[model samples]
Target: MSQNGPKMNEFEASTATEIRMDASRSTSVFLTIYSDFASAEKVWRRFEEYADCYAFQSFDFLDVWYRNIGHRSGVEMQLVVAWGAAAKPLMILPLGIETSKLGRKLVWLGNEVNDYNAPILAPNFGDCVAEGDFSRLWSDILDTLPAHDYVELMRQPKMVGHQINPFTELGLKLNASGTHMTQMSEDFDTYYDEKRTSKAKRQFRSRRKQLNEIGETKYVHPNKVEDIHASIDNLVALKSEALKAIGAPDFLAQPGYLDFYKELSAQSLNEGIGHVSHLEVGGEYAAGNWGLVFKGRFYYLLASYNGPKFGRYAPGLQALVELMRWASEKKATLFDFTIGDEGYKAEWCEIHEDLYDHIQARSLRGVVAQSLTNGFLLAKRTIKQNPKLWALFTKLRAKLANHRDFG
Candidate 1:
C-alpha cells in the first residue's frame, strides 16, 4: 500500500446514477489493458492493500478464482488498470473475456463465485477521473481490446470504496434482487438479542431447536486440511442435491465450479479470506456453508443442507444462523447475505442494497444475445416477485425434475 495514498474519506462521494461532469482542474487517468495477470502484480497488490474495495476484488481471491474457475470455463484475463500522471496507480478493474456460441462477452473475474464485482480504486480515483472523462476513457479501453460482442457486468454495488461506483453512471438496471446485510455486535448471543426483535429471536431459536432435536448438533469450522476437504466434499454434495432437486441447473456438479469451491475454501482457511464450515446432527454432517470474510465484512456466498434428511428441520436456515453467530464471534461488523430476495435473508438483514447490471451490445449478435438474456431474466423476476406464481413454479419444477421432498 502506498504510504501517502488518499484515505477513503478523502475521495469525493459520487452516485452511480449521476454523472460528474465537472471540468475543474484536477488529475486525469490513462488506461492500460493487460491480458496477463502477473504484469501488473506489484501495483495491483499495493492498491488492493488499501483500496476502497470489498474482498471480492482481493488479489489472491480473484487470482485463484481465475485459475480454477474462469480459465477452466475458457475465460481469459483482460484486467484494466487506470494510471495517473507520474505513473501512480489509480484503479484496477479485474475483468475477463468469456466466449460463447452467441457472442464474446466481457465480464469481471471471479464472475461465478464472488458476490460483488468491482474495481479496486485508490482513494484519489474520483479526483483522477471525472465521470465524463472516465466514460470516454472506458470507450477507448474497449476499442483497444480484442473485439467483444457485448459486455455483461452484473451484481455491482452502488458504492465502491468511499466514493460512488463510477459504473453507476452507466445507469442502473436494478437487479431483481438486492444485497442484504446486518450489523454485528461484540458478542454473538448479545448481537442475536440486540439485533433481532423478540419475535425474530424466538423464530431463530425455534429453528436451532429443530436441529438440536435431530441430535447432538454443533457448528463446526475445521482447522485441518483433511477436515476442510471433507467439509467441502459434503458441501458440494449437499448443495448439488438441493439445486438439482429444484430443477435448477446443477452448476456445482461441473468440474470447474466444484474445484473452484474446494480450492478457494482450503486456500482461505487460515488467511481469513474464505471460510468453509458445517453443521452436524448426531455427529454427521447435515448442513454445509461457504463464507468469505473481506476487510471486516462477512459474505454468506454458498450454503446448503441434506434437504431430504434435514430440510424439515430447516438445516439450510439454521446453518445461516450459525454462520451469523460465528461471524459475530470473529468481530465481523456486517453480515452480507449478498444479492438475493430469499425470505430467510429478509428475516435478518436490516440493510437491503439494490444492485445493478450493465449490458451493452457492440454488434448484431450481441443485440440478439442481450435481448434473450434480458427476456429470460425478466421472466425469472416476474415469477420471483409473485408469491403464488413462485410457489406454482417451484411445484411444477419439482414434479418435472423428479425431486425428492425434504419433508
Candidate 2:
C-alpha cells in the first residue's frame, strides 16, 4: 500500500489526499480523495477502460455535466477512488457533498441527470469483494467522506456488466420504479416481430401509414455536428412545451440543463457514443431523441416531439420504431428506456430492470432526516404506482397551471 499527497499531481489546486488501509492480512486497499476535477481526470480515464463501466459513468459524460451543471448547483466534488494491492485500481465512487435543508449530505455525482448510477468498479472486482472486506471498505469510505448527515445513493443498478453491484450487497430499499428495456434480436424484423404483439404491430403500421400521409417522412441519425446541435435544440424546445402543457415543471428550464446536454453532445461527437436521432416531416423536425450507445446497448435518454402538430400521426412512436431499427443495424443487443415506467415504454419493453436507493444515517439528526426522507419517498412512490391517484394528481397540477397561465 502507498500513501500520497496533492503534490503528486501538479494540477491539484484543491486538497488532494490519499489514505491506505489494510482490508485483510494479505489484502490491502488505498483510498484517494480528490477535491478538484482536473486531478482526478487521469485516474478516471484509466478506470473507464474496465468493461464494467457504462456510458453514463464515463469521464467525458460526467466531466461535462459536472462542470456545466453540478458545480454551480452547490455540489462539491468528493471523488473517492480505491486501489487494491500493487496499486491496481479497483473502483471509483464519484460522489459529491452538498448542504440542503436537512443538512450536509453525500450523494452520487451526476445523480441529477444520470439514469444509472453505480461505482465504476474494475473488472472482476465486484464479485471478488468478501463481505468483511466490503464492510471495511464502506467504513473507510465513511471515515474519508467529509462531515455529512447521511449518505444517499440513488438509481443504482443491481448489476453492472453481469457482476452484482457491491452497493446492493450492502442492503438498500428498492427505488420507486423499475427501468424498462427491450432485448433486441440480431435483425430488426425479428426484433419487431418478437417484442411487439400482433395488435401492436398492426397499430404501428397504421401509425406509420398516417405519418406518411402528412408528408415525405424521414428518420435520420444525424452525424454531422451542426445537425446534432439543431436536433438537441429541437428536442429541448418541444419537451419544454410538452411539460408546460401537462402542468409539470420543465426540466430543461432548469439552470444549466440545456448547457449540460450541449456540452455532452459536443464532447461525445467523435466517440460515436452520443447519438441524436430525428423524425422529419416535410423537411421539418417533428420529433427528436438523444441517446447513448455503449457496450452493445442503446440507452434511450431524452426524447420529444412536436406533439401539437404531429400528435395525430404519432410521429414520436414512428421515430422510436426507426431508432430501434437503427439500433439493430448497429448490433445493439438491448434498448433501455432508462428510468421510467410510462405506459408507452411498457408497450415496447418487456424487461424490467429494478433500481435501488440507499440511505445511511450517521448520527441522531441523520436518523430523523432519513426517516422523513424515506417516508416521503414511500408516499411519492405509492402515488406514482397508482394510476388513479397519479392521474388525479396530474389533473390537479394541470388545473393549477391553467389558473396560473390564464390568470
Please tell me which predicted candidate would have the highest lDDT against the true structure: 2
- Model 1's alpha-carbon lDDT is 0.76
- Tell me model 2's lDDT, rounded to 2 decimals: 0.80
- For each candidate in turn, the TM-score is 0.87, 0.92
Task: Give the alpha-carbon lDDT of every model.
Answer: 0.76, 0.80
Kindly provide the TM-score of model 2 when superposed on the true structure, using C-alpha atoms: 0.92
Where in model 2 is the C-alpha error above 4 Å? 1-24
* Candidate 1 local Cα displacement, residue 148, angstroms: 1.6
Model 1: pairs clashing at backbone N, Cα or C within 3 Å: 16-168
Residue 398 in model 2: lDDT: 91
Candidate 2 lowest-lDDT run of ten = 7-16
Cα distance off (Å), candidate 2, residue 277: 1.4
